[model samples]
Target: MDATTLNSQAERFLAELHRSPQTVRAYRADLRHLTDWLRETGHGLEREALEAYFTVHPHWASATRSRKQTTLERFCRWALQHHLLDRDPTLHLEHPRLPPPHPRGLRREDIERIFAVIPPEQTRDALLFRLVFETGLRIGEALGVHVEDLDLTRGDEHLTVLGKGSRKRTVLLDDPRLVSALRRYLRTLGYTHGPLFQATKNGRGGPLRYQSVQERWQGYAGRADMACTLHQLRHSHATELVNGGVSLATIRKRLGHQHIQTTLRYAEVSDSTADAELRRWRRQRH
Candidate 1:
């Protein structure tokens, strides 16, 4: 009914949901936007207030509106269940239909071109790019990796990555090129401890910042004359696996995707695959 009530309930709802910090921040932002609108219009937490707000902001993008709607519905349900409200304001709310995701990634040649620019002197930076590309790791997961997480001595060499929602998954280090590069990097460092990628600011070391990673990636992208982002390396890795006939289930586990549907977005057909499939289909028909 009020901003204070909404904020407190949102915190409880997010905690009960066991949402990731990133998700919690997003939900808080969405709630703030709605609460601000309510205050400006002198409205309360009711279905009429929500619909009126929606009516006022007709130009809001579908994705933005959809997120707000979900936040509102979630809050309304929580309020009703807790007897904070007489009825659910979002009982008759409609969910927006979102379009299917088409994830874009680098081709094999593109990856090669980007790697060409990183010289042997920058082994640390090169290793960073290779790790993310080879492992299909989110930047956060890759940065969070510790020295102990890498198991290079054992058979089926792999590294452990802590993914979204604090889920841990093993990423195999099967590529000879990547494996060799990692070995060289570790040898050069002459020590096997602490963060896999360490950042030193004012003589203190810690995990690398996301902004630092992005800036480094952009620098490499510019030198290589390519348009890419650190996140795109992950997409490129997934695309490569899918095109190589890797199973969806294996890809899902490797990428640490909670849902197979998220992995399915990478099932996009490459130009070569499309051509091959068409030729095969025509031959079978004939």
Candidate 2:
């Protein structure tokens, strides 16, 4: 197959992917990688070439391999259906074994360090990161929040978020500091509509893309000299609530977890938190 012909088919496949723009971008990047490798090796898109590609990437973790494999499989299937290829090379490819779920929660002190490093002038980023931390919101959910979804009434302040599976849930804004910061952000942003977090590059208040959000968070983390990730902030929130004796049902609802099992994955209490619980229990016994 000609490289130009392959790229054209890949572009069509990505355009028709019709998933989230982020998902399409991921597939495009993966395909681009494969195409670049093919160009260097002078190999066609076939089973042997695909196998050789995976063989060279021995450093790829199972999750990374799995995601890339999925991208390739989807593209190959589309190519076969369009008669661009004779067969699906990825059909017989072995799936990578993903590791067990391990939710990591940053300690309060580390979280503090991360926040402290943010310059006082970048209130938008400071508020965005804090919102995810305090509310246990997935980065996507936090980014998807629209201005209209916020209900900052005197007594009750909450925001409706579209979580995984397109399920909508209301996240309570009980932290006084967070609420105060959010209010200040709103005053700074005079827009009465559109995404709560916007892309500064566009100047039209367009929704911030996921890749940009991840890169920006990484930049802040690097400045703090910490390795904290955007998603870890969400885990830190759930772990905080769990250690504070919050009910699993409540945590599940707040995090918009469709199942209690997902919430349970992050319910591990720290040693200090467990010690505090035991001390409280002893005091109650007296």
Candidate 3:
């Protein structure tokens, strides 16, 4: 079949799946790129054709190429299952080796400066930002927190969060300063129940939307002149724990990482830890 026809099939396939809009868009783009290459080379969507295309167009970054390869493989598998193709072309396709970059986290100085610059009037923003940094919680996980999820009573203090894949995990609320901030913010909101972070409208309460928090975060970033993301707070927290000699298993559990490899990325980012290891290695060599 022609590239355009196959491309349309791919689009229809993706539209029927329960994928996020962003994911659908990316998959569609990947499909389009593959079809375009096939058309240019006068080839069918076959294994040999794909291998040739990758060989000829070897300019993509490893990560980008890997993503595209995954997208194409999924598409090919679907096509084969649907009888659009006689066989799956991606069954034996090898993805390019990905060189994982060091995880980027905010410097201690940057974190301090940013927190210090948070205006007193923006207590909610301050609390949200600090909460994520203190507990390696993703922005979505932080925003998803309900009042009932918190256990700030005298003896125990932790928040239960629904992490990726709807898995639940308990994260400690260990910082007294953060606990104080949360208490004050909750008091100001007069919210004795429901979402810990709430939206106010006409003196009524509702769940605070992610978009509103993102807009507020943009303003905070601009004021602090820090080009960082809310997600980076999670990375910063994880890196801090790793550098402080926290065990990988403990860090993985705290960060809700399914794999220790994900938590190990923080260790990769800790230059001080790397330096210490290098010193140990040199002493051993001597």
Candidate 4:
């Protein structure tokens, strides 16, 4: 079947998976890109057709192509499961061997500058941003978090987040401040279930829009006289872990990175930090 006519089947694929609303919405958007490509090229969901679509925009950054590739690959896998195709076209597909963008994690004081201006009353903003920074979660992942996803059970405090490819992984609420902030935020939530961060515009509660979150973040950065993106918070978290000598394997799982190479970008530490690590390693070896 042509991807151009995937609305119904795509909806089915999305519905069968237990993903957050934001994830579902993001997946749907990616599917539409595929649908448009099929309409223009009049090709079915074949391997060559998908490859052509991916290369159509060579100027597109590797990250953008990777996201689309992931979305299409998942759809193809679903189609195979339901007998839509005789073979999985995306089964042996390989991602382009382009180096991922160098991670731009911020320093502690640089991050603190942004946080210093978050008004005291914006407790929700504080908790939400802090969670992403501490946990290295994609902004969408953080926004998708529901109240029920949290497990603050005594010493085992953690968050069960739905990661990429609809995979569920446990995110430990390892930061005492984060756990404390979470509890404080929960107490102020007034409701027992639903999104952890609800949109409060016009005295209404609903799924917070991603755009709204970014806009609010920009405002905070402006007040602090710094130019920062919301995603930099995640980058900063990864950088901190790398500087602290955390293993790449652990960082990969913590950041939900698909490849260790992606985590390696965060390993670009300052000269002093790298020297310190080498010094400690040599002393231990001696």
Candidate 5:
């Protein structure tokens, strides 16, 4: 088919894909680039032509090529369904292999040093960081916390977190220091109802946006010379818990993970610790 016809078909196919707006825009851009190449080379939308186009385009990185291939594959599927094409061009496209996993975590001293750098006036931000690190909460979950979710009067010393997929779970904050920090922050804001951490203008209260929290974290990290992201705080929390002899099942429930496998990724339990636990269990049984 001609370039104009192909463009029209691609647009319709993307509309039918029902992907998120950002994803749709990206796919559309990739397809447009492919279409331009096809027109310039006077090549038809055939499998051999598509392969040649990729082979000739040395500028595309492996990851970019993979994403483009995925886009074209989806488009080809739609085209085949609509009889726009006889066969899929991207059926045998190879995806780039991802690199090895590198776990990012902060040592206890690093955490302490970062917190110490926070000025007293920015206690709210510091406490927010502490809450995420101590509770293993996603940034969204921490930002979504409401005043009612924190039962400070409860003797159990835990906070109710509304986590991913709107799942509720109780995450313990066993450290009295963290609890006190939270209480002090709440008192300073004079926030007794609704959201616990609200936006403020010269100490006047409003709703806090997640992006604002993220920017604050970036600024704090920059100032402290700490090579860490906010999400790493969650990792630190999980690592600390795993090292402290907390069971995987307990951590799973506390972290509000739907799957145990998801929780297992966070458990950085040392081999020595695992062996010791196994020996302890065996001795008890004997």
Candidate 6:
């Protein structure tokens, strides 16, 4: 088949893959790389050309190689099914191996220090950070929050969050202090309905752009001398829950993660607990 035909086939296959938009974009990017490499080598959309390209390429790191391989594999699978190729060229391609390591989580004191650095004049910024840290919300999810999402009534104390893939989940706001703070902020803005955290002075709430939020966070991090992103606040909340003895499954559900493995990364065992476990193992060996 021609190169244009092959590229078209790849796009159709990707559409059929039912992957997320982000995944589809990455696959398209990877395929473009392959096409570019082929053009440089004066090779067409044949199996021999693909093999020649891989033979000269240096070994890539685990993550990078895996992503490239995945893109090719998907393309090959689609090609084979459609009779474009008799066999898959990427079937024998090797992906780099990686070692498992625990995810980095912030200490409770570090979290406090982050909060302490927020300037008093930037009440909105402070509340944004606190809400994300306390709720374990993804930046997009937090930005998507509406004023009606927060319920501050005596018995009902929780926020309804719309997470990735349009999934809705209710996360508890058990801290009365946080609730009070949120209420006070809301009162100041006079936001009774519509988007909760909006970009406005008259309180006619409109969507708060993510870039503005990120820029504000960077400034806060700079002043505090802390290495933090909006995501770190989410990590802080998840780590706190895991260390406080909350179940992995519960955390996963609360965080609206489709897989349990995503939640497992957030688990942070205390150093003392790790030491005790090591001693117990040593005693057993003895």
On residues 110-170, what C-alpha lDDT tens digit does candidate 6 reach at each position? 7778779887877877887888888888988888888888878776889899888888899
* Between candidates 2 and 5, the lDDT winner: 2
- TM-score per model over all chains: 0.63, 0.64, 0.64, 0.65, 0.63, 0.62
**Superposed Cα deviation of residue 129, candidate 2 (Å):** 0.5
lDDT of 2 at 74: 84
Q: What is the lDDT of residue 250 in candidate 3?
A: 95
Please report, as a residue range, the 10-residue window in candidate 3 with the lowest summed lDDT: 263-272
Q: How many angstroms is residue 124 displaced in model 5 relative to the true structure, after the best TM-score fit?
A: 0.6
Give RMSD (Å) of candidate 2 vs. truth: 11.9
The residue pairs in collision within model 5 are: none
Q: Find the candidate with the highest lDDT and give its number.
A: 2
Pairs that collide in candidate 4 are: none
In model 1, the runs with Cα more than 4 Å from the true position are 1-101, 202-204, 275-286
Residue ranges of candidate 2 with Cα displaced over 4 Å: 1-96, 276-286
- TM-score of model 2 vs. true structure: 0.64
Candidate 2: the clashing residue pairs are: none
Residue 9, candidate 5: C-alpha displacement in angstroms = 37
Clashes per candidate, residues 3 or more apart or on different chains:
0, 0, 0, 0, 0, 1
Model 4 agreement with the true structure over 124-160: per-residue lDDT tens digits? 9999999999999999999999999999998999998
Residue 203 of model 5 has an lDDT of 67
Residue 94 alpha-carbon offset, candidate 2, angstroms: 5.2
Local distance difference test scores for all models:
0.83, 0.89, 0.83, 0.86, 0.83, 0.80
Candidate 5: tens digits of C-alpha lDDT, residues 92-166: 766677554546678889877888888988777878888888888888888888887887874677788888887
Error of model 2, residue 121, in angstroms: 2.4
User: Candidate 5's error at 97, in angstroms?
Assistant: 7.3
Model 3 has how many clashing residue pairs? 0
The residue pairs found clashing in candidate 1 are: none
- Candidate 2 lDDT for residue 3: 62
lDDT of 2 at 149: 98
Off by over 4 Å in 3: 1-102, 277-286
C-alpha RMSD by candidate, in order: 11.9, 11.9, 9.6, 14.2, 10.9, 11.4
